[model samples]
Every structure is written in C-alpha cells, then in structure tokens.
Target: MMTIGMIVMLIASVVMVLASFLSKKTTTDREKSSPFECGFDPMNSSRLPFSIRFFMIAIIFLIFDVEIALILPMVMTMKSSNLMIWTSTSLFFIFILLAGLYHEWNQGALNWSA
Candidate 1:
C-alpha cells in the first residue's frame, strides 16, 4: 500500500510539472497583458472617486444579508422550540430590522435620487 502511494505521488508530481510547462504562454499580446476595466484606461491611477451613496447602499445590503442568515436558523429551530418564546423572539428580531429600515428611509440613506 505504501509503495503504491509513493508511485502515485511520483506520477502526480511529473504530470503537474509537465502540465505547468505546457500551459505557460510562449507569447504575450499587448491587449491581453493589460487589465480590462470597463473601457477605462488600465495605466491610469486606480484611485478613482467612488459614490458615498453607493457605498452606503452596499453596507445596508450586507447588513440585511447577515440578518437574513441569522433569521434562517431561527426558522429551523422553531419546530423544536416553545411556540410562545419562538414567536416573540422572531417578532422582536423582525421589528428591529423593520425599525432600522425605517430609520434609514427617514434619514434618506435609502433614497437613490439626490
């Protein structure tokens, strides 16, 4: 068994080396070598100005995504847990999420238009 394992390892190593050599590019194209950036020049400074509104919206999305992950487990546990306790806990969590969304709406963080 040990001899078979060693033979397999040796074969794998040789195949990987051959594959690596064969896969390497012999010639590089100027267009292919340059980074593609939605028609933007690749040589230019990459530190372009970003929209604060877009960033805020992304953060909001991530927060809600995480909240959804947390809520899914609660759903799975509902069958085994006490009905009254589970219902209250789920309601409280949902209420908090709604309150946060309302707050963001009121603060104009959710608004797309300036």
Candidate 2:
C-alpha cells in the first residue's frame, strides 16, 4: 500500500512539472498583465479618489446582507421556539430594520440623484 502511494506521488509530481513547463507563457504583454477597467489604462497611480456615496451604499448593502443571514435562522427556529416570544422577537427585528432603512432614507443615503 505504501509503495503504491509513493508511486502515485511520483507520477503526480512528474505530471505537474511537465504541465507547468508546457503551460508557461513565452512572453508577457503589458496590456494583459494590468487590470482592465472599461478600457482605461491601469498603469496610472492606483491611489485615485473613491466616491463616498458608493462606499456608503456598499456598507448599507453589507449590513442588510448580514441582517438577512441572521433572520433566515429564525425561520428554522420558529418550529421549536415559543410562538409569543418568536413573534415579538421577529417583529422587533423587522421593526429595527425598517427604522434603519427610514433613517438612511431621511438622511438621503438611499438617494442616487442629488
């Protein structure tokens, strides 16, 4: 069994080495190597200004994503949990989510247009 394993390892190593050599690119192209951004040159300074609105929208998306993750488990736990407690907890959680959405909406974070 040990000898068979050793032989398999040897064969795998040889095949990997050959594959790597065969797959190696002969020449590297500057355009292909750099990141593509809507046909824009990526060779320029990477420290470009980022949009604050875009960042805020991303953060809001992440927060809701996490909240959805938390809420999904509650559905499964409903079968085992007390009905009254479960109802209150679910309602409270949904209320909080709505409140947060309202706050962001009022603050104009949800507005795409100025």
Candidate 3:
C-alpha cells in the first residue's frame, strides 16, 4: 500500500511538472483584453446596473424548489410514519413556505414593473 501510494504521488508530480512546462504563455495586448461586440468596441460600461426584483424572484424560486424537494421525500415516508406527527410536520412546513411567499409578495419582490 505504501509503494502504491508513492508510485501514484510520483506520477502526479511528473504530470504537474510536464503541464507547467507545456502550458501556453499569454502575451499582453491592449485589444486582446478589451471586450469585443460584433467587431466593434463596447461604447458603454460593461458593469451595468441590474434589477433587484429579478434576483429576488430567482431566490424565491430556489427556496420553493428546495421546499418541494423536501416535501416529496416526506410523502414517500408517510406510509411508515405516524399520521398525526406527519400531518403536523407537513402543515408546519407548508405554513412556513406560505409565510415566506407572503413576505416576498408584500415586499414587492414579485412585481416586474418599476
């Protein structure tokens, strides 16, 4: 096992040395660093302000998607689990999900228009 590990480490080091020597060297050029858009140089700033609403909506979607994934597994375990415990747990989870949704809705994160 020691011999095998040593051999693997030797091979990895050889590979790393070869990769470093064989890698392409980048030449510094002003035009190469500049952003190209349809054969024309960019007229405006590349870092433009984005809508916060879109980001909020995406986060909300991810939260709900994860909740759905959690809920699906709970459904599969329903047969083995106690009915009262399962019902209460599911209702609690659903209530939290609804509360989050309500909070986002009230915050105007769901609104598309400025």
Q: Which scores greater on TM-score, model 1 or model 2? A: 1
Model 2 worst lDDT window (10 residues): 37-46
The digit string of per-residue lDDT tens for model 1 on 25-52 reads 9999998998799978888999989987
lDDT of 3: 0.89
Per-residue accuracy of model 2 over 22-110 as CA lDDT, tens digit each = 99999999889888888566877778899877887899899999999999999999999999999999999999999998998888878
Candidate 3 wrong stretches, greater than 4 Å: 33-44, 112-114
TM-score to native of every candidate shown = 0.67, 0.63, 0.77
Clash totals for all candidate models: 0, 0, 0
Q: What is the C-alpha lDDT of each candidate?
A: 0.93, 0.92, 0.89
Q: How many residue pairs in model 2 have overlapping backbones?
A: 0
Order candidates by TM-score, high to low: 3, 1, 2
Task: Please identify which of the two predictions, 1 or 3, would achieve the higher TM-score against the true structure.
Answer: 3
The residue-by-residue lDDT of candidate 3 on 2-59, one tens digit each, is 9999999999999999999889567777767677877544766677689898899889
Q: Which 10-residue window of candidate 3 scores lowest in summed lDDT?
A: 39-48
